[model samples]
Target: MKRLLLSAALFVSITAFAQTYPKYTNEAGTPKSTSKPPAARLKSDGTEMRSETVMPSRITGDFQEIMERAVIQNKEHNYAAAISLYTQALNVANEEQAWRALVSRATTYQTMDKPNLDKAIRDLTTIIDAQNAPQKQLAYIYTCRGRILQEMGDIAGGCADALKAKELGLPVALMAGLEGCK
Candidate 1:
């Protein structure tokens, strides 16, 4: 009698657990629902509820076009136009595009009549601090920041960045002319 009751209890518990967590889809593997909820639907904490479905923004095409235009503007020596387009690209950019846009904007600033070294430094520092950037790209960013710092008369800071770039495997030729890196 005890064995029978224990077996029944175990079976009941397994059935209850299985019923509580149903499969998200049928055997065909298609999603159970295709409809998405309205974006304005939110919980008390200003977060999306478990039942709410959010769609990802599709803007990579627009981002690429804006970045291309920015590059063209930069090549034409239209620093203001290039900077504006780069900013727009940044708005819709993913991780890779954001880094590229920031670097391009920093380079554009360097060519301006009155270079905004501070802004360039901020942008570069953002990338560095994110820590998810590729090593080669980080090396280039550090080198660029180092050059800007040198231009701004921050010799020690420039040297530090230069050394960092070198440590990250920047070509020896590129570091050859950077003072204090040797």
Candidate 2:
């Protein structure tokens, strides 16, 4: 089931699209994508290599509704609205759903113009403190935060995060090794 509403994007996608999209667009939300991001990625090789946000088949109810709306707002570049909805989703979401929303929010804040580095790290760190998501999920968050820290000139913090991500099996951290991350 899909519903479409237009708005601006802040951090993440909502819950109603069937197509999978790459993670985020620029702060301006150019080169628009028409689908929500997958909570998980394709962990296989060969012809199966592609990037997209895959929604589970069973998402339904109010949590789903909020997430879907948030996606719409995010895609439409209604960032403030998207953030509010994601926050609303938090109040209703279960443990797994909360993790998803937090990831979405953290990524959003990290990427938005005049990126909120502190808020982004705060959200990512909350997830880290929980340690509830699977290792791959944690690895992804680490890389996201690491990139933010690097951008903020916290090379040590960023490198630590990148190294942690690498330790958790995401080789992308190695690729994220900015100039001083040796």
Candidate 3:
């Protein structure tokens, strides 16, 4: 009876050990794609295969493309290319799009090795003078123009703009730097 019990115990242990761990395989099996299927699929025999329908973009305009390319050129330090693209974008852009292009171009001008303060001021002023412009954008424009004014030795103008920006709820910590304001 003891030998019989031992044999049964050994059989149970072997069975448990065999089924304890899972089998791992290196095969990738069939590919599962989450993206919309290709518009056209070709089989090995060069025959077209049916695929899931894919939708094309509805946004058709050169303005967005020009703006995107201009931003890329600006980041790469190719100011001339960026400026040209921005100009093209402005020509094809609507009023709101034109505003964005102007602001971007003005910022790029300010960032150049030789800052174009005149053009920057003009761009900011245009935005400020636009009909129904947002107050927050106006505040930013005022602060930007004020900095340019101060740099160009117009202390009074700079101070006045700084005061305006402060009144518009923008933080103007640099007001102390405008010596002529007091």
Candidate 4:
């Protein structure tokens, strides 16, 4: 009789738990649409047209506000505040957005007194080396790393990074100080 009761209790508990959970559809629904709908090109009639479901501006505005605050702190030479804000942004940001914040914060560290220049260099270098990093982004990381090395008086290493930046097609102007070091 005790065994029968225990089995009933287990079955009831499992049923209750299962029913309380919401059903997930296809693992959060089919993968997000990658391709844009066909462009709404103007017809000869020239009637006005627009895409359906415009993205909300508030989402982008929030990210921009956070990034702007980080930039302002860096400009004011408040490295700690800038780094903190950048980290907050990174936590909520997409892949490209996070990379931008990390690169900016690394530069802020280089600009601070008694800066951990080696760590800054390493941070930028790792981002540059990322296999999936966007192509245009590699130049920016190399430029930042070069500046940190140049500031620390490692002319040879700085020049190498600067050259790498240039080879990646960044404008020569970004490597201004390292030009002579080359």
State TM-scores per candidate.
Answer: 0.64, 0.63, 0.59, 0.56
Cα deviation of 123, candidate 1, in Å: 1.1
Candidate 1 lDDT, tens digit per residue, 115-147? 777767777776787654568768767876776
The parts of candidate 4 lying over 4 Å away from their true place are: 1-62, 131-133, 179-182
Q: Which candidate order results from sorting by TM-score in descending order? A: 1, 2, 3, 4
In model 4, residue pairs whose N, Cα or C atoms come closer than 3 Å (at least 3 residues apart or on different chains), thus clashing, are none
Ten-residue segment with the worst summed lDDT in candidate 3?
A: 25-34
Off by over 4 Å in 1: 1-61
Candidate 3 local lDDT, 3-26, one digit each (tens): 344234323432433363222111
lDDT of 3 at 45: 100
Best by lDDT: 1
- Candidate 2 lDDT (Cα, 0 to 1): 0.59
lDDT tens digits, residues 110-178, model 2? Answer: 546556667677777777877756677677677667766776779798889878877898655233333
* Candidate 4, residue 85: lDDT: 74
lDDT of 4 by residue, 107-171 (tens): 66665765777656655764665433455557656766765676677768778887887788866
RMSD to the true structure for each prediction, in A, is: 24.9, 16.1, 29.7, 25.3
TM-score of 2: 0.63
Which RMSD does model 1 reach against the true structure? 24.9
